[model samples]
Target: MIGQGFRGPGADIGDRPETFAMAQALENCSKNPIDPEDGTAIMTTDHAQPPRAREQFRQHLATVLADLQETAAQDGEAVALIGSLATQLSDKFRQASWSRAKDAMSADNYDELLQSFEKQGNALHQAGRTKQAYAVQALATSLVAGTQRADTVIAQGEGLLDALIDRSVALYRQHLAKRH
Candidate 1:
């Protein structure tokens, strides 16, 4: 019993208080068979919400909108991109209807789409689609120029929408890190 953590027939039931406590702990664990360190049940399901990048992007757009209202910021490629994103994200957020799930892609999938925005645009652009070609060219230009002129980017056809999002996320994170 001493070697086996005082379990299964030790002659003395009345031992040190510490020994009784240890035995009680072992009995409780045997009865429960759960990991106690993390204070979490083993059979629980994760109910966490999705990543909030799109939501954050929406808020960022609102800030831009406010800035525009107050004449604190000028519209640019970033504005154009943000406007498009606002519309799309609105649908995803179910602002229009409850049945948006069929048409809406998940935020993770949307992020992936942005990452391959160039490739996807080029695929259509190369097929002699006039509008697509224009968009691809514009997005490429915005990406190469390293500027956030959202209007021109949208108007010209397409620009590196993913890069714009990535850049915004990085900048926002940097700002937060500094604030902390």
Candidate 2:
């Protein structure tokens, strides 16, 4: 199985430099696998990620949020657009996580096995973390636009759930691959 440490970089989204460094180290180790007894394969190092990628991800997230906000502001189109945005956001997260997991696993860093597991677990947990917040904001926006209704709210919630299923299936495939 691919080591978990290699998976850390994709999942690390915090202010701590140390965390990023550790994740980078794990990624490096995965890329350059060495004998466990050899001191050359160190487990930790200070590695900085490219700023451009981070900025891009942040911008993408902002764009999604803004789009959801704008969609909710509409009256007749609220339900349809909200459903579509939620589905799109959910797909984005799933694709991102799958890409990360695949990259980490392909690195072949044995030391990162545990960390990869953790990343998988954490990714699964936070898969839909933004959905609740988005739904709330969407609901608020809908209310402001006089589009609030139990049916609309429930439909939005159901659409989000469907998105979660897509993510879950992708994750499960990764998990199954690791197991076999």
Candidate 3:
């Protein structure tokens, strides 16, 4: 039987019975050919690390949200810009996640993923975060200027109203004196 096994032109039946036993075990355990459409093994292999990847994505999203929130609290214009950019960033991340879930991890596809991330970072930077920092620094100056202007207008209007009231009272007093 051993000679028959080794007689196959290039067969290497070594002197080790353990090796033969292992080969027999592997042959016995071999599964039937898989159908292309039934990709359970592939799905399990690819999705094995999905939870870790999801955690990483969530961390990145949190960072983006925090940065956008800080920028939005500065001024109306900045809030508008940052809020829009944040929305775009969120859409890009969702697209990236969908792409990954679909197993489109080719080099070109990865490059697109990287480009999306870069665009989000660039948008965040350009959304006036730095300018918002400056706006915060100048907030006290703006408040003082605004308060002074409003106070001046209010004081002038109040003074004019007081003068009008005084004149009306004087006129009424003169009318009463004449009636007496």
Candidate 4:
């Protein structure tokens, strides 16, 4: 409970920016809950994630994409159709995010949720939250753009689903095998 009751630097958790984690910590557990044998408290941070977490996520992403590719292959026309859809959706998505129109994705009323998802996903990847970023990308991949297919939308907007996922997996796996 050391960090509790005291608003140390960077302890800001809410609007007041004081005694935030303190309250949660106080409510969650004993002042010094320790095991009779070990006599120590476990410490971890939700915001500060480990690097391997991303590597694992990268692996998971590769698996999901590979599975998706296999499943998509069953549709016969899915690859070609989705590629075409990807192109259209990417164009529209770009128009929404980067174009000068007031109705763009950046606009308050237009697809704000999607904008948030894309921005947050990229930020996650940048912050070593690769798994979460991949999840976000996967979410976007499942969402349709107007009448377009979900796979096509995500593919056209950022990358071909199969290629992006495959490359990310290989890179992460290699990195994982290298060092801590």
TM-score of each: 0.22, 0.22, 0.23, 0.27
Q: Please name the candidate that would achieve the greatest TM-score relative to the true structure.
A: 4
Model 2 C-alpha lDDT per residue in residues 1-180, reported as the tens digit of each score: 111121121223343222212222223222333446754433222223244433332333333334543443443233343344434433444543322322233222323444443343344334533333233233222211111112343235324433433344454445546889
Candidate 4, after superposition: displacement of residue 80 in Å? 6.5
* All candidates in order of lDDT, best leading: 4, 2, 1, 3
lDDT for 39 (candidate 3): 36
Which lDDT values do the candidates have, in the order given?
A: 0.31, 0.33, 0.29, 0.34
**Clash count list over all predictions:** 14, 10, 0, 1
Regions of model 4 farther than 4 Å from truth: 1-49, 77-85, 94-180
In candidate 1, stretches whose alpha carbon ends up further than 4 angstroms from where it belongs are 1-90, 93-110, 133-180
Compute the lDDT of residue 17 as modeled in candidate 4.
28
List runs of model 2 lying over 4 Å from the truth: 1-49, 75-78, 81-180
The predicted structure with the larger TM-score, 2 or 3, is 3
lDDT for 61 (candidate 4)? 36
**Model 1 TM-score on a 0 to 1 scale:** 0.22
Candidate 4 has an lDDT of 0.34
How many clashes would you count in candidate 1? Answer: 14
Candidate 1 positional error at 30, Å: 52
